[model samples]
Target: MAARIDEEITFRKLEILLAFLEAGSLARAADALGVSAVSVHRALHSLETGTRCSLFRLEGRNLQPNDAAHALADVAREVLQTMAQGIRSTREIAGYAADRIRIGSLYSLTSGTVPALIMALRLRKPDIQTELVLGSNSELLRKLRDGELDATIMGQPEGTPDIESQLLFEDEIFFAAPAGSPYAAQSAIDLAQCSDERFVSLNEGYVTHDRFRDAFRVAGFEPNVVMTTNDIFSLMNLVGGSIGCTLLPGRIRSVLPRSVCLVPLLPAFQMRQKISVSFLRTRERDPNLLSLLAACRSHAAERPLASG
Candidate 1:
């Protein structure tokens, strides 16, 4: 008689368990999942606890899956396959048939790049519909990996090999301050010169937020962060209010209020964010995805070079 798997075990846990079985190691499974090894270990431990069974045996620091683990993995594979097929069939029957492309993008791009791309795509395929989701870079990448989004426009994704990306354009980062601030008069300033200045930044999980921190690291000082918010516009508003200075991409210059001044960073301290259209490589052949990718490429080619 076979042991019953825990009903509380989630599909994600099962997927992790199956990954462990196939990869034969936690680190390899984590690599495949685009997560940390600690995450894999936690999932596996949770699965074992929920099942109340020893699915793996530790042998000289390596976890070896037992027979029970193999059986569970087999079941997990079948379940996932069935779910995928069911979803595809339902969508087909509903006349959706992948006609709608769900795209994710960074909040900042929604104002210009996203709208332009959507307009161009609509012109090319009037019958198609697009759903645009805005989020931080890490959030969008996670959605893309989980199959929640067909593709995403974001800064170049790092450490995520499962995603294939095409560079759209290069955007330069600029130092932003209140219009009346002394820094506004300079043509270019080194980041170190702003070491004592209060900074307003995006919250963690944003690519720009990471880049902001990196700038501070390069400048050899910790930033005096006075505010952290999720919205780029809100951060800009704070800068305009003279709350603190910030680093922003040139693409946002059109929306900047006159109260805010954007100054160029010295060449040595300058940073550029490479915006890209990214999607799971597995969906490269889907007709709708292909169309969207083509539109993105076209739009990127037509965009003007980033100004300082």
Candidate 2:
């Protein structure tokens, strides 16, 4: 009868060996593995004992793998890759794969590009169902980061590390006032003229709310906010009544009633918005996510989006 082998090989041992080979020293290998040097020493000892062969020789500060250890690298890598694939497959079966995508966007996109994109998606893949969430930039990004939203079309979020983005459009921000107002008659008005003037602005956390605030600051002034509201319609109502002037996007020109006029900012300060599609890069390849991405790209290409 053949002698039964009692040695047990493990993935951890393989990882340690690989780390050592690449780092060329126990201290460096430990750092790469996020462990201490003493832990690395123990792992190497375990691996050496299991194989019943000398794998490494310490010379100066370097740990050099001998021939027997060097020869096992290819096999170790193949095993690790196989294990990773298995884990990925398990995650897919658990509904972590692209089975569904939850989309979020700014309210403005809902009226035009977003609706067209949704219809186009349904036409392309009738069986795919999507959940659309509407909110301002800050809320959408919060949901996106919290994993409550799969993707969102909002102004570019600053300092988001794990999020990925693709730019779709750039639009100028304009000053909007009721039609026939002296401010409306001018092609452009200095931002400072309104420094002490009453204004209507979006509720806190809205993307444009911040943009308008920043513009005021840049112009060396602060706005006299007469009112703040979440609904754009309400803001429009206030502007129409001449209650206050508010910042608006140029795209709304054709849509807004004749009672509203969009004028350029003095010295022409623009928010230069870039409507983008954003999602976690790790989630990009999910099938449902892939579908959503395709829809956004197609819609962007077909629409008359603002350029540059």
Candidate 3:
């Protein structure tokens, strides 16, 4: 039978060996590594047993490294360096982009959510670079699933088994109308009452569009969607121009056109989206994603989020 993992020399054993050599004493090594002295002693003894070589000598009460130990230390340093380089090279070749994080997000989140996430992430990883790709929910999620993005910030995927999501915050979906539009003065709007209005919504692939269709369905009417655009800016422009009305999220309220307004939907037509840091289930433990997820949790804690 092959030797068990405990019986074989390992990377951890090599690291302990190097630590002991530099620290010069088992107690010192233990302190340096934040481990028990017994553990440091055992790792060295275990490594010596695996090699069947005399790696240490007892000089009075102190244990000192022998020729074999010094020789192995040299080899261990090179082995660790080469292995680390190889792993980094492999990750790069496979499009992992270790030094750069590729992010995809909905345009509406740019004003607040995405910027906060990236800023918080920088506190942990100052040298890391980020590339942002903005699109509708569907396009961003597709890029995430295809491995074209390292992670994405968007509405949580519904029943997506292959993806993992960590909720950052919840945002209300509201009725958007220009200031001078006929319906802008209303304190609250109900979707059912606006069936005859000309609506210009985002194109078919956005999460907001999904909510748009669902809300109208519950209201017992097909929306008179007279125009559709893929750009949130253009959609907002159309609304600001009073060309048509549409639904939008509350996160972009600060950036809404000076003449446009976001009116809350009445209780009966109210809907909310859970904005999250989403990634592939396979990348749940990726370092960059782990940092981003941490940033999401931190960001959520700082905000006076919408309550359930």
Judged by lDDT, which candidate is best? 3
How high is each candidate's TM-score? 0.69, 0.67, 0.75
Off by over 4 Å in 1: 1-97, 304-308
CA RMSD of each candidate after superposition: 16.4, 12.0, 4.6
> Which digits, one per residue and each the tens of the lDDT, describe model 2 over residues 35-141?
99998888888878877888878888666788988877778889999998998887644335544557898876676767777777677667766788988888898
| C-alpha local distance difference test of each model | 0.86, 0.78, 0.87
Worst ten-residue run, lDDT, model 2? 92-101
Ordering by lDDT: 3, 1, 2
Q: Could you say which candidate leads in TM-score?
A: 3
Clashing residue pairs in candidate 3, if any? Answer: none
The alpha-carbon lDDT assigned to residue 146 of candidate 3 equals 83
* Candidate 1: C-alpha lDDT: 0.86
Superposed model 3: Cα runs more than 4 Å off: 1-81, 93-97
lDDT of 3 by residue, 155-179 (tens): 8899999999988888888999988
Query: Where is model 1 poorest over a 10-residue stretch in terms of lDDT?
Result: 91-100
Clashes of each: 0, 0, 0
